[model samples]
Target: MELEDMPLEKKRDGDGEGTSKLVVEAKAEGKQTEGNARLYLTGCLFFTLISLVLMLAVIVLSVKSQTGSKDCPGTGDDGRCWNIFPKIQAQKLDCHQCGDGWLLFENTCFYLSTVRLNWSMSQKNCTAGKGDLAVISSQSVQTFLTGKAKSFFWIGLKHDANQWRWVDNSALGVRYWEDNLSNGDCGLLRGDGPPLKNWMRASCNSKAYFICEKQHTSLLTILWTTFFMYIKFCRIYGGDKKDDAKENLSSQLSVELEGERGKQTEGNARLYRAGCLFLTLICLVLVLAVIFLSVKLQTGSKDCPGSGEAGAGRTSTSLTATCNFDQCQTDFPDIQHQKLHCNQCGDGWLPFEKSCYFLSTMRSTWLMSMIECTTRGGRLAVISSQSVQTFLSGKRIGLFWIGLERPGSQWRWVDNRALGDSYWDDNLSEGDCGLLRGDGPPQKNWMRAPCAHSAYFICEKQA
Candidate 1:
């Protein structure tokens, strides 16, 4: 009777305890699976967000590469793009082809003759080449010719009928004539003398080397130079590292997803599938990024404006436009600003310091010259210092009406600034307007002249 009772009690205890233990194990397993799915979902979302951020970074870098590093204003319809980028047009090699033994400078080709010839013969030779003898139109041209001149060189200048004239019949606006004005009518450039006063008159029959110039063909080029620069930058800044990091992260995620799939129950299998979908989405994003970059790399716009090309005339309308002309200049100063020419100051102008100067070919009265400068959005040049005076004197061969004027008793600039440093040739209280005598010493070149006197003038404006 005792043995029978013991067996019954043991059976009841095993049934109750074993059932409770099975229920607890099942609940624990379910909780673990839910936690793993939540973790995998969080990881997928995090990686997706990271991929999105990386894609955006690529887009931003590509845009920055398209435009220059410096932001400029006054280029867009809303006044937010850089005027400098458009100005940095790359000339196509095919468009500007200088003959062998000729040097390309700006839009013109220069050739220094090996044989010596008289002024008349030199002019004839240049005409034969469809050009003319060297015309010192600006200080830059003068400098260039001076650098190339080994000895005396006959230029396109002759003192005819008391006035110096170029081969093209244009009166000499800027001159580099030496102090000693000889009786010779032809112009000779002295390579050994000071650059400012290298020109000396000589007989037309005197033998000397010559220079020839001609206009270049039209500008034709695509703006792929900037795009290539961007490609170079990406190559330098670890493009491979970025790809490797992306690949490594994606591979790690794939391995983890596979492990999750192997360990998960049927319910958690959905989570594994979702992770695979997320991975596909990431790959799609990567593919899209590649496509976007490829398209951007291939589609660079033409930079040459007024070339009659459809894309060349339109300005950049990106969202990064925000700077004005003045602001753009102030933000990014050019490294070789002093070397720049018409590109900085425009045609028929010279850049000096922060100013652009225009020496007029047409002569007019002092008042009329002032009016001409005003109409051209400039004013008569103001000689404020010795350097400026020297530069002005070195640039011309004849008298020019400056901004100086006597309004009442005191001499003042056209801008109403009181005369500080005077460079008067004589203290004669005779005329109201001032004339800058280019042939005289820079320190004592200013002379009072009649306001009604006709002469060439220098116009000044901020560059």
Candidate 2:
């Protein structure tokens, strides 16, 4: 009802109630607005924190990339810089490239001298080239030197205090001594003989050619260079952004880059898996081929027997088979049958008196040679008789290891027999084992030598 048409007391009561309801509704609307404002502020703060975290992650990644690059040096025409993200042109290096006139082998460079010089002077020449006299350490290296050395050449070996040593002050572990020499402080390699019989001792003042050795550029250097280049490329392409608009743009770019990288990583993974599978297949095929070849070889050997006289000798009824095809056997009925006896020596063994001897073609250490002989059900040859010694000395042209050894302070045979009727060389001063000197006199052909020296060995067994 209108205020003008209402009674005074009733009108006052209705107006107070309406006014109170309006005040309560106004308070509720103000609280709702405040809550909405607070929620909006909280959402803004959360987004800002997330953006900051993403920026921090990017910075950390950049720092790691930069730190990793420090270990790798610069290479190529652009110094240390690279454009990896854009795939721009950059220089590459071949780290294994050797210097001019230097031959590469494994990870080392070797230079052979054509002119002659004394041992000291040759070492000086090698030092001038930032290298040392070639130190022979392996069979492959020894073979290489043997091929290059046209005549007696000087090596890094020197006799110090009656012991042979290398230029690096390392004691010789694997020796290839040709003979036990009393004099000569320097080492020489004979270019004419086999590799096992090449090393010999000579005077230090003797003039001869030499070899120099040095390390070549390594693969690790190339890997480091590549890593540095990649880091430089990342720094150049992933520059920093300040404003939000630029930051958003960079975020989009980074997302795209990540997508590309993911795709590339997947592709590389697939390629690696495929390569592994292909190699596995190749290995399996090779294994199958080897098995098939081995089976075929065994079958062929079993099927094809010895031919002609050998076959006839192997058969038990040779006369009956020969008589079955020929009437001439009836005409020569006076022929007598005889049984032949074979030698008692085993296969690949030489019969000498009541013993079987085996000469090794390969060179090995004294202990290793002993193992080989034991594996063959024998032991190293014991020179107990002068006739046996004379026979062995006549057969070998180079030093051959015997069964004699010096276990404690005295010389004894492998059979634990004491030294009797010794044939030791007069000039022998130091050594732990005895060797037959094939180039020396028959009466004094035995000489003392280090047990570690590589030489052809002799094994003996009962006949």
Candidate 3:
């Protein structure tokens, strides 16, 4: 009976040992599975993080390309390309300020006079203040001044030499004249009527309050501010969010992985929550990126000012999408029939077909010619119509520079319009500026010349 009991006790001990061994093996296998799951999760996370980083890099590079250092026609002293007119329209980006008692609007500063004076006296006072009398070129400008005007204000328009013209000698663009007003040479803005029809003809000697306008001098500073602000915002709001997400994910994983098998379901639940949070953050980032790109495109393309010939000094690339010949004709009716005897273009300028053409007697390089034309508030001539071509050809006595230039493989006008009518005298493939040969016929007189070569140039502006 004792021997039988001993054998039974040994068998019981063996059974206990076997049970312990099996439990240990099960625990080891569970640990291995958990380790593998963590490894797989980490790999997926790492790949996702890398992909996010790469995507962000692509976005940054694309933005940089748009605002890159392409040569602007008028570079500032700091070697930075600054667009004057376009920057004006971006008032929120402006860092400039007007003087005391001056009102700031767009890219210009205006000052309302406290005293009444005649047109000549008002202009003289404005000039003394380093500005000119208010010149309203658009309906927005008219509305702005109309809001500020309490009484009759002397503007820069005048019926000079039989046609309405601005003080700068530019022909009126959009008229706001009230037909019932008294006839006179000077222009006045009446504050009591419709904003668009408040203008009235007044005597040059009539006394009235005046408005003065001057261009702001802080363009370069504004550009520097905008560039740095954009970079800083991108760093703060664009790229750093990903790093925060990575840190949060790491913290969550460490906290959730601390427990054993009993907490396995809880760990998986935490992991799901973490993954959802990460995915949500990523989705938010993508949405923000899309919004950023949309705004950049709109501001960089559509709303950019200085796209026309008058404002193309900063960006040599013109955004004029259509041929302006018909528009020019529409703006000035019967422009071809308008008498040249009006002398509206002043001395040395010849008026033809709603535009004024000035042939420089002195010779200059193409770039210098463009600069000079810009200074004179005009551009190098763009010959669009056959009549204009005949007129320009007839006026030229030598190789004269025009506004046409080959920015790329195709020749384009300075205003960025594609070359429409061809009058090439030679198949010249090398040179940047277009030259009109005076000796050849109008139909076949165009020539290409080196931009660096000195030649007579013709400047044109709205007459």
Q: What TM-scores do the predictions have?
A: 0.31, 0.29, 0.31
lDDT of 2 by residue, 359-423 (tens): 88888877667656644546688888888887777776788788888879988877667988778
Assess each prediction's global lDDT (C-alpha) against the native: 0.64, 0.60, 0.64
Cα error, residue 153 of model 1, in Å, equals 52
- Candidate 1 yields a Cα-based lDDT of 0.64
Candidate 1 lDDT tens digits, 109-181 = 7877654657887787677667788878888888888888777888888888988898889998978889887
On lDDT, the stronger of 1 and 2 is 1
Candidate 1 or 2, higher TM-score?
1
Off by over 4 Å in 3: 1-343, 427-429
Q: How far in Å is the alpha carbon of 64 misplaced in model 1?
A: 11
